[model samples]
Target: MSKRAVILAAGVGQRLQLAADAPAPKCLLRFDGRTLLERHLRLLRAVGVEDVVIVVGYEHQQIADELDRLDWTPRPTLILNPQYRQGSVVSVAAAESALCAGGDVLLMDADVLYDVRMLAALVADDSADRLLLDAGFEAGDEPVKLCLRDGRPVELRKKVADGLRYDHVGESVGFFRFTQASATRLAQIVRQYAQTQRGGEPHEEAVRDLLLESPERFACADVTGLPWLEIDFPVDVIRAREVVLPQLHPLL
Candidate 1:
């Protein structure tokens, strides 16, 4: 079956400032002569996933203008979320139509700059519900974590309680694939979060809800030693250009 992808790019990326207090759109960060958004599009096409949707706000027109500059065939669809300042849940909720389209769907964050190998690994997985994990992530509350018990996903959150029992834990790559049925359910949960104006809850909360209730439905793919960075802070931008970019494709 064909798969679709929804990229959540609506947030202001407030933490990733370029100059003193200047919050730029994270997806527009350029590396190797291509914007992160452009790289994502090319990589998805490489893996045979062409049907794409992006949620944009916080200078969304810049995104639209960027899309205009690219001559990519079968241009991506854009979903605007004016409430991007509220929380990520609203952005996910805004893509409800695309999510509930009854096809296998992949959801991912726009801020990550990673090896194309990571994207390839995700697309090739056969699991009905999928999440990417990397054991090498730096220790901090900033990265969302995936906690597994006996090879099944038991918990996922930014802050895993100190004593939670799990065989192992890894940092989430912020990329996920869900079966048609699973996608529908996830959309509903986020929609509820959006409708109720739970403005502080990140989209991860809805994902954690589905995960805890049905651990049996999910499986994880490990991408240890992979070169990837979520472009959250200024330091990451420097590292991506200086460190991660060279590692994404070492032989090139």
Candidate 2:
């Protein structure tokens, strides 16, 4: 009955132009002197998640070398996704296959920056399938449109209708807490999409599709006040440095 975490870090980070010339992938981008993955590992370990797995692609060797240098006595396992260029879903599927067949797994996006407290709350909460909903400050195509019914997420589409305005915090904070059953279900969906050559779609695309095709499979977890940021493009790098650096430096 151990808790685990799987970080999907294989994407090429096409928007992060610096990644092309940098020494490591975007996840390896240094913020306040520590790599993003190192901070995430510390946060996960603090919350009793001793077993960790990271799916690496796009400069995956650099990621592997970084991990090898760590003196983390009992290091987490690393899964290399050969088809990482395919999409996030493929990276997730790779991690899922590496996980213990029947244990709970926490899934997170490698590029997201957030408060450790959010993760602590997620670890403590009990949810069959939890999706963190951010009450964003802006309304743009960057964040998923969270459609709620009775205080729960009923539908999450890419864009809402024109002139329809709701506070959209942004895209997923890249973190999820799940039971083995939920992990298995999600993995099944990802696998189905990957095999059928539809894996190029967004990770949430598959999740949303599953919900539409079968409503009983997912649940929403409230994280309205949590401070989080998703670092995808160049501008987000500054934002990530601003928010994640201050909080993580002292710990690192």
Candidate 3:
């Protein structure tokens, strides 16, 4: 399988600023003496990902400058999403070419901080397309919710109307793996969606549309008990520092 990664880092991270008075992009926020983007790149390299594409918009230069300072073996390619102010899906759309060029692609949200083992497990899986699921899910409107049936995700929505209906539901870890064919399909779908749909829709909506076309094409990788944190609010950063970071240290 081809090891490639595309990280969406274009968001303005308004919530984090409102909560923590963050002055820079959320991915640039420092924790445990390292930036979130830096840690993600390191983890990807450690897992044998040879090529990477990072979509940048909000404070793009800062991110670029940070990259310039880092001595990466195979430097990442940075793509600017002009419509970043609109939504995250635009960022994914911007990297369509790079994603389709690779054999298998790893999609990630730059705000996420996770243990390398979680990603390692997903890489080890034989599935052509997979989405990481946290079984120890926290119910909320912010996180994308997954409804699983027979160990596979049947539905994915940010806000499920009747949350109690599904016997097995999990929280999406904002990480995914797509086979080469699936990656090409995703790029086509994203392009079509961008032309027809308005902005502000999460990128997951596009993936959901792809799944609707062929539900059996995608599978879920249960990554429960793995240490990971998505830094959306100030409180999350605190938890990442106090909880997630400690758990990931041993694995690192």
**Top lDDT model:** 1
Clashing residue pairs found in predicted model 2: 136-169
Residue-level lDDT tens digits of model 1 in 1-252: 779999999988768766645455789888988899998998888788999999998889889888999967788999999888888988999999999987789898999988878877887766668889999888887989898999988778989887888998899899998888888999899988987858558898899988887888887889999899988888989999998898876322
Q: How does model 3 score by TM-score?
A: 0.93
What local distance difference test score does each model get?
Answer: 0.87, 0.71, 0.82
Best by TM-score: 1
Ranking by lDDT: 1, 3, 2
lDDT of 3 by residue, 183-211 (tens): 89989988876777645678898888877
User: Which of candidates 2 and 3 is the stronger one according to TM-score?
Assistant: 3
**What lDDT tens digits, residue by residue, belong to model 2 across residues 52-118?**
8888877888888888877664687889889987878888777667543677778888887777777
Worst 10 residues of 2 by lDDT: 164-173
Report clashes for each candidate as comma-separated counts.
0, 1, 0
lDDT of 2: 0.71
TM-score of each: 0.95, 0.87, 0.93
Where model 2 places Cα greater than 4 Å from the true spot, the runs are 161-171, 210-219, 247-252
User: Which residue pairs overlap in candidate 1's backbone?
Assistant: none
